[model samples]
Target chain A: MKRAFIPLLILGALAVVSAWLALSFGSVNTPWQTVWQVISGNERGLPFDLVLQLRLPRAINAFTTGALLALAGALMQVLLRNPLADPYVLGISGGAAVAALCALLLGIGGLWLNAAAFAGALISMLIVFGLARGAGAWSASRLLLTGVIVASGWGAVIGFLLTVSPDAQLRGMLFWLMGDLGSATQYGVGVVTLVLGLGLSLPLARNLNVMARGELTARALGVPVARLRLGLYVLASLLTAVAVMTAGSIGFIGLVAPHVLRLAVGNDHRILLPGAALFGGSLLLLADTVARTALAPQQLPVGVVTALLGVPVFLYLLSRAERR
Target chain B: MSVQIPIIETRDLNLSIADKAICRNLNLRVNPTERWGLLGVNGVGKTSLLLALAGLKIPQAGSVHLQGRALSELSGRQIAQICGVMFQDSDDAFPVSVLETALIGRHPYLHAWAWESAADEAIARAALQAVNLSDCAHRMTNSLSGGERRRLALAALLAQDPTLMLLDEPVNHLDLHHQIDVLELLTQQVAQHGKAAVMVLHDVNLAMRYCDHVMMLFGYGEVLQGPVQEVLTLDNLSRLYGHPVRSVETPEGCLFYPGKT
Candidate 1:
């Protein structure tokens, strides 16, 4: 227990540093002293507005979104008992992408688009859940297979929506599809959901550890496997929905963050869940900071930077794990 | 004899897989300080019957009772407190240390928000030591050999420390020495702790040497059960396995093998 704390504390420190860097370095490049003054409420005017109104909320949204995705990814992997399972593996993101694209074609923007994406995610979850639970016994492989097939169906719809839409809206649609934290203004819901997801999942962490072994073993060892699987599916899907609604369909963090942390902390979900959240939130915050500043006035989608940064780290961890 | 309540009892229990009948009208009682061996042919629903006994599978007819209460009335945690099952294979979907895996045995006893106490860790360590896995406690489960993995499963069950244990092919993948070692450990647990065990075994010789009671299931719901001496006759053994069997008496016990045509 004591050993698990060290890595988590380090990740928490990284999260703070990442948030500070995100607030300080941007298009205007505010000085650290001014940033600190604004944070401590000792300053006023444009720097204060820029720090408090503009960057702080965006940073919170980015961190919360990243935390949600990573937590969802960890849950999906455990529930399905597959390392390849990600937050989007069950078609939740694909469904949101399709709905958000449709809303885009219909001249919808802002909050309505978020709502549509969330509805689509829930619909997709239900369909996959119902189909996977089909006339036979439910299994992880069956759920995964159903989810994969449904995601492909959603992909075709998204493609059709993109091709048929007006040429003028193409760039915005593409940015959203590729994941844009630029328009994220509502960080409150995302923050709440991240906290709730982490809080609820932590108590079930030991059951999740047993579940990683197998459903049969879990049941034998006193875990109510059926109920736990259902709860996990719902929780992970809700987390993915909130993430997509907050920042379109940010990729890589959901898949890679948990994997990297599993190497550092082992597979104990008690530590892995929160650790992935911190590590993933920090990584995305840092990635978003780079996305905003690296190209000057032109911003790269946060997804691109996430993959760019995450792949090398994930590969390094994998190689190190192999050597060990 | 004083009438001590059986740890696990099945009343008129019927178990089947698809069209195959594993057992029918089976009324079996496993008392404390007893080790019962379940013997049958491959794919004859031995595993299914074991699962039913463990309250993991619902019987096709009738019911099972644990500690004088209906098994259906118990929760998963409640059943786990009384019964521990060791599966044939250890599913390692993610990497975890051997000691962590053993610590899972204390899961049923702890509250949702509670961590394992120091005494619980001691129990886990003692279990590992019993299985000769103390040196490998910190090693990852994936690093263990097949025999070592088998021992780890046993260690986890030992840490669970239930009154009744249901083991499916406990000796599978084990070397000869480790197999005997594991069975000896189980026997000692049952005798010294007043525990009960129902294990499925393919090796008739080992069952003869270790188990005091035997239950033989023939497909189509046929079964013969009694004290090991009365139930382990050459005729019943051959009929149970659908093959001719020959036995030779030894100082230890009677050893049975296939008859030469």
Candidate 2:
């Protein structure tokens, strides 16, 4: 109990400090009080506008997207009972990426891209669920294999679409594929926040816990296993879709955050779910800060920065866990 | 403690896998106070029969009724509430504490959003005590020895407080003492609490000693089933194993020894 409490307290303190550092320490260094004042809507200067309009929304977007991705990843890992299973492992992100790419290449609007991505993700999850059931009732190996098959097929379709798209729209589609956080707006932030809040709450946490024990056990325990699994996949897909639509296919945050949190804490979904969300948010916010400040005048893509930082840390943890 | 209704009943049940018949035209009844031993050699479909009884496998033909309701029609949770099953080998994925795994037996009674109540916790604790695993409740399940895992599995079943228990090779890895301890516990539960238990035991001697009734499955669709002394004879044992065997009845119980004459 004491061991659990101390890490939680320390993580909580670190998150607060990170949030403050994210808001205050940019290329145009606004003072802590000024950042607070801007956040509170008491200031009306250009610095306030810079903080509120640009950096603040970007920070919040990164944090919320990270939280959503990590939550989805954690849920996916528990649901499949495989440490390697993440949001992308199920072809959910691939599906969303395909839809987003089509929207961008076809000259569709931004809002439509979000909807398209969400629909694609939902459809892909349904297909995966159906295929898994058809093959033989939610076997983890079957699900993983099915996901790989579907994801690869979808990736091929994405490649075909990209080849056929007009050259003028290619740049924007490429940026979306690479993942960017520069396009976050007030409305986008609000929408992602609402979705993230709903996704991270009680239902997902409780159901994820039940799912940690294999599906048959979950069913025997009165979990309505199929329904719960379907619901979780849909909810996770929705969260991933929103993140993908808003910030492109930000890869490693979703795959890495939950796993790191799991190593720090244990595999109890109640703790891992919330911990993943918070730690993911903090990590992404820090990554975004680096993306903006490292280049000064020009921003590196937040996705690139996160992947660069996440991979080594993730590999080290994997090796350490393997040794243990 | 004679119950009016049989806790489990099957009528002319048939099951097959890939056109290979496992069990056919099988009928059985289990009273709430009975302890039944299902004895069969390897590949005799003992596990399959137990799985069918536990509602984990669907029979191809005929019916299984649990307390007068069709087993197929009952929800998994409803079946679980009335029947607890211990599989031959369970894949323990997470490093859950022994107490946490045992507490999962309380799942049928728990609401989706609520934590396990104090009463539920107390019952789980009592189950651990019953299995002599109270001291190891906080230890990781993966850390337990094979015999300890079997005991923990029994504790999990006990925590469910079910009217019927289905055990598939429940004594597979247990030592002699622990095996006797588990059977004794089951006997006590049947006698005192009116719980019905159906177990698949490979050891005919253990089955005869502890089981009130025995169901023997021989190859080529032959079955010999009745009270232990009558059904477990030299002829039946020889026919089942496809080898010559001699059975001796000591003052304690019956034992079978394989030989050629």
Candidate 3:
């Protein structure tokens, strides 16, 4: 209990600092007092608009997207009982990328792209689920292999679409592929908040706990194993789709956040889920801040920054787990 | 025994795998208060029969009934509620705690939205205590020894509190003391709770000593099912194991020994 409480406190402090830094420090460099006043409904002119309209939404988007992806990744790993499993392993991000690319090439704009991404993710998940089931039962190995096959297939399709796309839109597609948080808006942030908050909170947590036990044991214990697995895949795909649509394909947050949290805490989903969410959100917010300020007037894509930061941390964690 | 409906019954059951016949024309009826030992050599379809009984595998030719209702008519959850099964091996090599593993036994009783209630926790705790693993409740399962893992699996089955328990090689990795302890506990459960238990035992002596009834399967899909003494005779044992066997009766119980003719 003592150990558990200390990490929580540290995480809480980190979350606060990350949120504050994200809100106060940006390209315009709004003062803390003005940022506070703007947040408190006082008008502070153009700087306030940049703070409230641009930075605040961007920060929230980074936070929620990271948290959602990480939680989805953790849930997938537990459900599939494979350490390598993640949101992308199930072709969710690939499906969403294909949909987004299609929208870009065909000149589709606005919410339709997000909707198409969600639909593509759902369809891809269903196909994986179908391939995973044989003789009315699901095998984890089969599910994983199916995910890999479908993801590569979708990747090829996405590549074909990019090849045929117009040159003017090609640069945007490349930027989206690498992932950028510049397009995050209040509307996108709201969607991410609603979906990630409600989708991954309680039921998924319990289901994941049941799933961590082997499937046969879970079935004997009264868990509807097949149904629960299907539900988790769909929910994870939805959450990943939301993140993919909002921030493009921000890579390792999903893989790294949950793993780091799992190392700190054990594999209990109730703790791992919420902890992963908070840490992932904070990590992504910090990464976004670094990306924004690292090179003045030439912001690096948030995805590149996350990958650069996450790889070393992931290696350290792996060695630490190995030593233990 | 007072007249109560049989908890599990299989009639002329035929099961096959990949077009190879495993068990054919096998019939079994287990009273609600009986503890039956299923004994056979390795690869004699012991695990397959247990799977069929647990509703995990479908029979090719016959039907299995639980309390006079066809098992096929019941949902998996309903079957799970009435029958607890401990498989030979589970792939849960992760660091799930013993308490968490045992709590999964309460899954049949819990609603999709409801958390584990206090009553559920109490049941799980009692099951752990029964297996002498209460001290290790919060310990990670992967850290447990082989014997401890087997006992923990037994504890998980006990936590289910099912009317019928079907265990496939429940004592596989257990030491001598734990094997006796688990079998004694099962005996007490049958005597006190009137619950039925069907377990596959590799050790014939252990089966004969603790089991009230025994089912011995031989080659060519033949099974001898009756009271332990009648079904576990030296002649039947010799035929089943394809060896000469001798039985010695002592004050404790009967013991079988392999011999050359």
Highest TM-score against the true fold, candidate: 1
Off by over 4 Å in 1: none
**In order, what fnat does every candidate score?**
0.79, 0.37, 0.47
Per-model TM-score on C-alpha atoms: 0.99, 0.89, 0.89
Q: Is the docking of candidate 2 incorrect, acceptable, medium or high quality?
A: acceptable
RMSD to native, candidate 3: 3.2
- What is the TM-score of chain A, computed separately for every candidate? 0.98, 0.88, 0.90
Enumerate residue pairs that collide in model 1: none
The residue-by-residue lDDT of candidate 3 on B1-261, one tens digit each, is 567778999989998777666678888899977989998888878888888898877899899999889988988779988899988876554577898788878877776656677888899999999999999999887778888888888888888888999988888898889889999999999889989999999888888888889988664567789998688888888888889999777888667889867
What is the C-alpha lDDT profile of model 2 across A179-210, one tens digit per residue? 77876663465355546555545545555555
DockQ of 3: 0.43
Best by DockQ: 1
Poorly placed runs, candidate 2 (over 4 Å): A1-15, A106-109, A119-123, A126-138, A157-171, A186-201, A204-207, B1-3, B219-223
- Which one is best on lDDT? 1
Question: Taking the tens digit of each residue's C-alpha lDDT, what string does model 3 give over A107-151?
Answer: 886777667766777778778777777556567777888889999
Over the full model, what C-alpha lDDT does candidate 1 score relative to the true structure? 0.91
Clashing pairs in 3: none
Ranking by DockQ: 1, 3, 2
Model 2 fnat value = 0.37
**Stronger candidate by TM-score (1 vs 2):** 1
lDDT of all predictions, in order shown? 0.91, 0.78, 0.81
